[model samples]
Target: MTSKPLISVIVAVYNGSKTLQRCIDSVSDQTYPDKELIIIDGGSTDGTVDLLIANNDKITYWQSEPDNGIYNAWNKALNHAKGDWIYFLGSDDYLWKRSVFEETSSHLFKAESENIRLVYGQVARVTKNDDICCIEGDSWDYTRRGIVADGICTFTHQGMFHHRSLFETYGKFDESFRIAGDYELLIRAFKEGGAALFINGLIVAGMQTGGVTANCTKLVKETARARRNNQLRVITIPWLISYAWAICYPSLKSLIGDKNSRYLVNSGKCFVAVLSYKKNAILEHNNN
Candidate 1:
């Protein structure tokens, strides 16, 4: 006679009216019944508040107020979460399917007894036109190496779920990291003693390509800083390679478009039979 664990979905947004409805609809239509949706708006003036009010019935709790940044908004939302598992859903992103929660519930149920702090799968990176760019995420074996040794983030937060105990133990997102705070928090947990489980073949969300994280230089710099702050060395070869790719990716995407740019990158890597810290799921498909 045990009840299903509750999942608190937190969305932090600003001026996100355009895609917010899609995001809200995706969450509201989920098949899972034991879930709550919480949203924090960064005092947007672009009609985002209106949208929030219209969808108030579906939201467990929502607020429209100025916040420092994404992490700040997320930290604020944490104060109101009352679930065993927490998920951060981007206002510009949506769950890949309505059944995502129902499908992942069994994994989350099992993770409880195993004490796994992170349960993640893959996310589809899409262009503004909604064309899939690539699938992002790797096995924990690959993720652990990137986080622990290379100080790289090999997974997207949109596809990851955090156990409540992780926050109770390591605390919430670091507001200092504007773009890489999510990565920083994960680093703290994994480096200090946290276990993660990766669900293969599960594509949890579709993440739009452009965002604050699209500023490659700032993102890479902040990622490096987070690693340094977490006691990881900053000069690893993988880190250097990531920095180089970050610098080039924007211009490359601009010239060839997002989908083509990713295809080219993966194609080049496949020819060399070499893999970096993060492996693209598309590469395997393209190779075949």
Candidate 2:
């Protein structure tokens, strides 16, 4: 193997024909010279496979087979990655431009030691319908040049570059979760990982956002279990409020301030709060 491959761009795709070609094009266009793009396809029935086959010459390593879930496919790609650093760029999401590689590499190489395990610049998260979903603001205060001061935002799986050895120290992402596994990893990284770097720049990633609350119930349940399994940050104001915010507004519910609606929402909110604390405590204790 080469001495230090700078970055490993891993992508897990499933029936992604609608966006796979664009995603592949972005990787192919990256300006960085010493990087690898590992693509993992989960037996896509759509023309996704055909498209990938045509683009096979551009890919370093790729596999197409059924996997349990998205995270599982990602795990496979990680194992095959040889880059010194890792970045997970989803198939449905595209980079802001070809300069992403050049820009990201410049900042990442500044870290002389292995202690800096991660870095996240800004990202313009666009919706799948060709609409701007969130237009993030740059911090004007010189003291606040970066949006995320710490790994609190580490839970966000996109718009970041991570050290490859961080996985060896902290371990790869847990494949058991279908959602919010990123959250679980964020907590772990912040709690046990090394120093994190921030660039405070913006790259665009087109994400499908309508299902924000589509899986709230399942997310709540899985989170409840995960919290129990890895209890940390119990009684923290942010954690408590996170629990509250996760279930406070139901998309299917009536308008706010309705008497019965308020009660129901409050009740759900309370349940979330208790579960949050209990699970957080449990997980934290186990880690200790």
Candidate 3:
């Protein structure tokens, strides 16, 4: 691979008129010259098509059609991409800065020599209330921890830049999973010995509070199912408690008349569960 390989920024949208311009502009404003912006719109009717038409000069390849789900749309994007590295961006998300791709290129080139299939950086989660939370990408150790503990997701997809060969090697995202396909794909890649490099800068700013994964109950259940399907041991208690909290937290707050108290209780439970899992893992390692 070349030192500065072509990067494909793929975005799949469905009626994303409100935020599509922001996403498109972010990619257009990127300082990286050898990049292509490929957008696969799922037959949007909310003025998105007009906006796309107006910006046809900016987009390398774009098509609007009905698709089964986001994964299917992504698969379409992959088919049209001509770049060596692929970065998937959400319609609601944007690149952290104009220099994101420029800053990441050197690390990606080094990782390429080491045969790494993925390079990821940190993402700043922009909540609905405009609160920002930083989520870091995973190292091998962090990935191993996630395999053992079901409560954690090792990385967010928004900040990750994947080699095109990874899809050819491990297959595309499983279209059957409406919510947890990204998680499932990551687990499968790691299990198949696909190495990853974690870069040290912010790549994208993702909106945290919306989308299909926003339903905490569905997310927790799907995540557990993904873990089980990957043959990773699932810790039932933490997930069960999390599900219950998602469902009952509002009622509990109403009864107690204190939101902070409920938040603390939920946070404490999760903290304790993480500690317990870590303790058990350490014990098992020492015994072995």
TM-score against native, each model = 0.91, 0.74, 0.85
Among residues 3 or more apart in sequence or in different chains, the pairs in candidate 1 whose N, CA or C atoms overlap within 3 Å are none
Clashes per model (N, Cα, C within 3 A): 0, 6, 0
Off-target runs (Cα >4 Å) in candidate 1 are 1-3, 263-288
| Candidate maximizing TM-score | 1
A best-first ranking of the candidates according to their lDDT comes to 1, 3, 2
lDDT of each candidate versus the true structure: 0.85, 0.62, 0.76
Candidate number that wins on TM-score, 1 or 2: 1
The pairs that clash in candidate 2 are 227-279, 230-283, 231-280, 231-283, 231-284, 232-284
Q: Which ranking of candidates, highest TM-score first?
A: 1, 3, 2
Query: 1 or 3: which has the higher TM-score?
Result: 1
Q: Which candidate achieves the best lDDT against the true structure?
A: 1
Model 2 Cα lDDT, one tens digit per residue, 154-230: 13356667787677876877878887565556555654334666667556344444332235555555555455557
Q: Relative to the unseen true structure, what is the C-alpha lDDT of residue 222 in candidate 1, on a scale of 0 to 100?
A: 93
